[model samples]
Target: MSATRRQILSGAGASVAGIAFTGALSELFAGSASAASGVRAPGDRPPRGGYGPLVPDPRGLLDLPAGFRYKVLSRQGDPLRSGEGPVPSNHDGMGAFPGHRGRVHLVRNHENKTTGKLGVPTVPGLTYDPAAKGGCTVLELDGRNHVLGERVAVAGTAVNCAGGPTPWNTWLTCEETEDKAGTNGYAKDHGFVFEVDGADPRRTGAVPLTALGRFQHEAVAVDPRSGIVYETEDAFDRPFGLFYRFLPRKPLGGTGSLRAGGALEAMRVPGVPDLSAVRETGTRFEGVEWVPVPDPLAAETPIRFQDFGPKGITHAQKLEGCYWGGRAVYFVSSFARTGDGSAATHFGQVWKYEPHRRRLTLVVVFGPSTDIRLPGESPDNICLAPTGGLMVSEDGGGAQHVFGVSERGEVYPVARGRQNIGTPEEPEWGEFAGVTFSPDRSTMYVNCYTPGTTFAVTGPWHR
Candidate 1:
């Protein structure tokens, strides 16, 4: 069925009945439950198959529930305005911004770092480090979430993975890998967060947010009230991964402010000392403190192995997605146990951070990763839902999916992915990324990795 404004407007009042987002933080607070609505808060156990059973898609592209449907917004090899080799592959993270004149802009990341011809070429002054690949592209969409035009926003970076949208209407794309300067043909030191305006791609700065610290950066979420940036590291090296907070010298500076420098600290439990966060689900920890990292940019040593390491700084395994939630920041630790102070389990873990209270809680966990029948596992990217919940993109071993969690933590398949079998050795079982909503909440945008496809999904979400 064709998605229309009427279909969404007719159900908006009814779906938002049980949930309400108010205050200046409405945009950042994706889906936080209200007690009056009879919805449970974070750290609560979710019911199995909460949304509904997945109804297979006849077209074998994606599976959705009865009323929900999706439309392919962009596909791999789609020619861009710059003709940049049909949009480089490995579409990782993305941000959807409100465009001028009712249009929507999507700043997408091409997770490219190869020496091949797939990366976006340099655009004179707009390029960061022309010697390196892996940058972002901007897509303009109409009111109905249809693609209008797309062009390279910023090129000349490395491993342009997931990032969060700033309150000032800019996109912060983070490089997942930390390839130093002059090494592996890299012209400059990689592993830094660069800001790009979705509206004007040419204005993207050529410098990185050095104050934000350099490690295997994955994703970030900024608290608008305080402008405190909460970051997650995907470093699988010796010291493992750690949750971080960037205390900028000035708040509300908006974009291009982090380059001035700031205090980067690691999240830690005050009295308990060393914490690996390798426990069961529903685990809660209070008195969380921020320990200063001796060095933000560690060339020889990993950032997590600095003075904070011996001080018993807390750490997790493969910290991937980070999102600003109700009075807190929720992050995900994608699978990794046994050797990193965690127990042997294939499932992933979700954690919540309360900035005001300085507390961290293990809200949701996907256990027994060996079980292929579970609702969700190894959640990679996450975003707020209009239903006052969360939508997570699964990057696990089994069939990929975009899982939806309710206010009470109910897990169900909101969308199922189909593997495009092109080569006998490889079936392109796409992993979903960039699960964000439109400015008006009429549509939810997501992406798949394998074939690099972006989709706009809409339906009776609350129902």
Candidate 2:
């Protein structure tokens, strides 16, 4: 039996209600609660039968399942409709929204720094820092996934990495660097979340949302109900990064509401100081609490180093993707290796946090794997599939792929990267980022981090 598009979009199995699996796939995830933690051995391969198997693209760009195909919506050097020089390089995190006249609007981030191959053109009003090269660009696509136009949404931010969409139809583009002013010729201290209005680029003021805290931010997820913004820090130093939540002063007031100011706090799980130490899946942390970051702006010290009492704030290595689904916030730790100073080693881990219940659960954990092609390794930029599971963009070594993980812990490959930007002797495949679906769930949009390409993929999504 073929799965419907709606079923494929919202079919999260047991992790999400109203979806059930049968036969082999069901048995793959049909273990005891403890046994269903989604942990695999180092050499264990991911379960197959996702969309059959990926067929290499004749164009040698992206490989998808037999019936699926992709179209290049935008490229690094492509001309923009707004007459802005060109689409900037290093396309990173992105958000897709319902566009005017049944179209789709995408706000894409360029992970450029002070110096890069091509910087986001610093338009007069859209630019925040003249010396910064990282920002966001807005792209409009028609029903057929044709690019209607592309323009700068926000600019002049440094190291724009991965961010999340807002409940108010905006995109939060984050800076993944803690570089301060006077460093790298920066005019102002970098590292803040900036809101981009995908529907109307003019509404994006290029103003930094300072209250959200200044740190090495990876991504954010806004709770549609409470309007609280959950942020992840991607610092990979000795201190690591903290999971943060911003209590917006104005709840769900739409764009620019975050600027009204709110409390920035770090998450603390009583006895757990570092998330990397927890190697087991399905590990539950009860009564999780948030502690105020005395210095969110990091005027004297970074938020992670700020005093959070005797227990101290919890920290994690490589805190990356974040999204809100099933009334909880889902976040990712891309990978934790002992050589990277982590207490434990793992390919990846997905965590779910229940706000009302103050409970945190490890939903999916990828065990150590030497194989770089392992589907679940280094899962980044995750989104809730309309069909019922989670889609993860791979950022680890080896051939890159966008992976799908069912709610019951069934893993499958959705798409693979076949583009080799490097020479044949040293083939290099860019990491996948910004794996998001359109409002209609008919298209899946993703980014190739290098040579910077944005693709709109559509096919038999329900298979």
Candidate 3:
């Protein structure tokens, strides 16, 4: 899952660029009462202090604010409660759902390719392709953040990257590869989203939702009101990737609804061909339209490469994290550099799309910075804070951190990665992923990508 590392260029200090707006847009910038209930909207300036300075951890695994502490919930190679072999590696995107007896269910993705320390157990009925090695695991935890049980939810999928949770309490685990059945001993074509039922493993069939389009999927956001599924493609190639929306035939229908099929379309901004070309913050693109994907399965060519008439679909570099907040669907462009064939370069960008108005707004743009500790570059997996804000997991160079951006736009570190599973002579800090809060928001759960580990963090969230 590692891409070619690009040179870090020095530039003006980091800045969270934004412009003022009134009415609904203003409410969107602030915490919208109608926005996905507890989720906070993105877009604001960065003020200094947040919870407070992060205190170094005594265990040397994580660094958090003064009042915060974390517990290791699960680690790679650990025995599973189901006795289905050991845990898999490369823990990535995850979703938290309400479980029975006041328990919280977490469905986590294992971004494993053809190889890993231990593949997700291909338990007979739950396996999609025996040759594949990437899937999801469901972890049950009580209110106190104590693990109740953990088991395999889905198995046999490959390159399971980041996916979003549905309104019906299931998780959409996306495959982040375009490998075909004949390649690398794969028995089936990969790169499709699979629905995993965290509450009941039996309900998850491990079937791929092919209508959602086959590509290098990064993440998805579903509109609670419309049931429209918005998807992001993370292809790092020359043509880059296109933002997509899957209009399910069975919108809002629970579980197997996505299997009924839907139209997969790419988003277009008329004159804007590449989103990376947009430099200024608050750059609004009105009258946005959706173009039907010529081939959702991409049997012969990728969706982004397929011709979309003279207008063509809009593309962006490193389209990563995505989630529904209030009335808008927020997505991230991790970063763009000149060496990557992007029209322009920037450290990071967060975009807000309003379906009702057919408007796309650039809410937050991170200016270039040389500091590796800064939380402005390569922002990945994100979730709405229960206390009204957004928590972004950093996947950039140097030390990684889980950052909190309040509705007022105050950027602060929520936690930092200090774990070095590698040798002491060649230390490595794995990028943080799956930054999500429990249903009650009492505990925050995140994952370390390398030497995979899950953490349950508790602290004075209100403070």
- The model with the greatest TM-score is 3
Clashes found in each candidate (C-alpha, N, C closer than 3 A): 1, 11, 2
| All models, RMSD in angstroms | 7.8, 8.2, 4.9
- What does candidate 3's lDDT look like per residue over 129-209, in tens digits? 999989999999988888899999999999899999898999999999888998888999998999999989778788899
Q: What would the per-residue lDDT of candidate 1 be over residues 192-267, giving only the tens digit for each residue?
A: 9988888887665566888898888899988978988889998866567788899988776866777667899988
If both were scored by lDDT, which would come out higher, candidate 1 or candidate 3?
3
lDDT of each: 0.72, 0.79, 0.80
Scored by lDDT, the top model is 3
**TM-score, model 2 to reference:** 0.88
TM-score sort, best first: 3, 2, 1
Across 357-431, the per-residue lDDT of candidate 2 in tens digits comes to 999988666632322224555667777664555677766555677777664555566777778977899777888
TM-score of 1: 0.84
Model 2, CA-based lDDT? 0.79
